[model samples]
Target: MNFGTLYRKSAFTDNPKGGNPAGVWVGETLPSGDVMQRIAAEVGYSETAFMAPTTGYYRTVRYYSPEMEVTFCGHATIAAGIVLGETEGDGKYQLTTAAGEVSVIVQNEGGVREAALTSVEPKYTGASDVLINEVLSALGWQPSDLDGSIPPARAYAGAWHLVLAVNDQNRLAKLNYDFERLKTIMLREGLTTLQLVWRESADVFHSRNPFPVGGVVEDPATGAAAAALGGYLREAELITVPATILIRQGEAMGRPSRLTVEIPATGGIVVKGTAVPIETE
Candidate 1:
């Protein structure tokens, strides 16, 4: 199928070698859904962002994984923002996604480009004991493996994620779960991912996301989950308002990624990261 300019970018890392790779397709008009899905499957990334220019500074954006279209994707959005900056100059661009209207800011800092996205208003719900137990069993984790301080919850910014905080960093490191089992549970619960985390400090966290729904075994840096986490913390009154937290992910997978999250006293969460072009054949 014929297409417009396509760029391969690695988001959340200044270095192309260290972040999650995503395909960014910029076109005057979006292709058909089937075509987009085919291209996304061919690109074989966690997600591919398709952007089409609209009236004024606004753009219509859609995210597709290898398997299906997702409501929103953070890393791909960052990559798309950087691409838009390079093409249209750096500034805030309005994006219309399935979730809602979102704003992304792209700017060059210290000769490196970075993008920050403001998520939709966050909301969350407590995870039922039965659901939590089912997930833990699928993950082969026992009740003692959890951090009693941070209770399990289902959080949403642009998508739904199961927030599970473990007690130790070591437990977080050894991530081995039954993919099909977890996938079944996630599908049944309408979960996009399992946000597995270990709190290193008050402002620092280590995360690992199992994205069986997206046809990805693990996501290196999950922007949606990160935003959801910020919302969950605020809703639970676990962190101070106007907090800036750092999330380190994809480390164990060898593609270390960093996401900076800004949690305000109220309203949407802000997540920032950098994206660099990746050379592809």
Candidate 2:
């Protein structure tokens, strides 16, 4: 069957070239898992979002990659929101996802239409060095490459991630890994992506994500990971409560994404970004 209309938007960055680009499929109904996976692989974006309206104002959504389906995706959600703002009008849209019902606030400001998605309840747990070692081995990185401040954690918002902070920027850039091995470990651990980060400044972070489990090598911008990082910072008491942090990602791959994360003492996190439509020939 011919696929429905699709929109390509780069989430997190205002410009089309920047941010994590996502393919959004909007229609009365989404395709089957196999079809969606095939389409996602054909689209070649890290993640593609599919949406169908629910009973009320809420919409049911799902995310797919070249290989499989994921519980949730932050960048794709943002991209869907921007599409809604233009097509469905600017306002709040409630989405029913596999994870939970998430609310997106859509608004157009200064010619930029953006969406801020409130995540599901975020939580973090301490990870053992043994588990971290498995990931390090697959990534061909040493334990010393990590920054000792945050420690390693299995963080979750809408999806699960391993948050690894590298001490040196160079370590973050040289991302060569055994994809199959990492995918096996991540699947066993029930992880969606491995969040690799380097702090560029006090409030700014440069990040990368290895998403082998999802059939993608890396994610330029990860909203779910950003929310998980905010939760980790709060749970570990690494940052001040009720703080706002900026995450810069995808620069290594030349697709820059900027995610704004808001952390409160206790609550679900808010990940904000803009999605611009990318014309396809």
Candidate 3:
């Protein structure tokens, strides 16, 4: 089947150099899983989106890293939405992803086209002591490196993420870990990424995402993880519900990104970011 224009987008930032890169592919029918995997590997992005005809006006979307399929990915959604908005015209695009249905609003304003996606219902649960130990061991991080304020927990909106908070920014900046061991733990835990974070203030946070399970070293702008973290914080009463917070990621990798998470007084948490296309060869 013929495919729409494939684009690379830097999610969570207006500049090309400041966010995570994602590959967006739109088509009538998805390519073989193997082909999609190969393309994702070649792209070498943390996540690549494959969109195809579902039933009706909705599209079937799948996410892949270099190595495997993921239940969800937020950065890739924004990228794909921008591609669709440019080609199909801007408004709301309905997607049927593995995580479930999500709505994306795309708009071109002041000659800059951007997209925002609302996550599925967010949920979380506290991590067991044994699981926490296993996670810390996998990353080769000692208990002292963790902040007790935000106890370890598993959060999910579109994907599963292990949320951990570090007290120091220096700790956040120095992100060296055992990739092989972390990958094993993440796969065992059914985690898409470990959302390592440092709270800057009541409304701001600095984050680092280790995504070895997805065959990537790090994620610059992790929108799905941010949404999950927000939900977990609210649900746990760690943070006030119905608040809006900003998450900054990828600065440690020099890509610096910003993600705005709005925790509604009611239903699903909204993850907001902007995506612009990168040039073709």
Against the reference, the lDDT scores of all candidates come to 0.93, 0.88, 0.86
lDDT, candidate 1, equals 0.93
* Candidate 3 off by > 4 Å: 1-4, 54-57, 109-111
Report the Cα lDDT for residue 201, model 1. 97
Number of clashing residue pairs, candidate 1: 0
- Total backbone collisions, model 3: 0
**lDDT per residue as tens, model 1, 178-240:** 999999999899898899999999999999999988899999999999999999999899898
Top of the candidates by TM-score: 1
User: Root-mean-square deviation of each candidate, in angstroms?
Assistant: 1.2, 1.8, 1.9
Task: Return the clash pairs for model 2, or none.
Answer: 19-256
TM-score of 1: 0.97
Off by over 4 Å in 1: 54-56
Per-residue lDDT of model 2, residues 1-281, tens digit only: 54477889889887788888899888777788888888888998989998885123578899997788999999999999988888888899999888998999999889888799998989889888889999999999999899998688999999999999999999998999999999999999999999899987767888999998877888989999999999888878899888999998999889888899998889788999998778777
Kindly provide the TM-score of model 2 when superposed on the true structure, using C-alpha atoms.
0.94
- Identify the leading candidate in terms of lDDT: 1
User: Which segments of model 2 are wrong by more than 4 Å?
Assistant: 1-3, 54-56
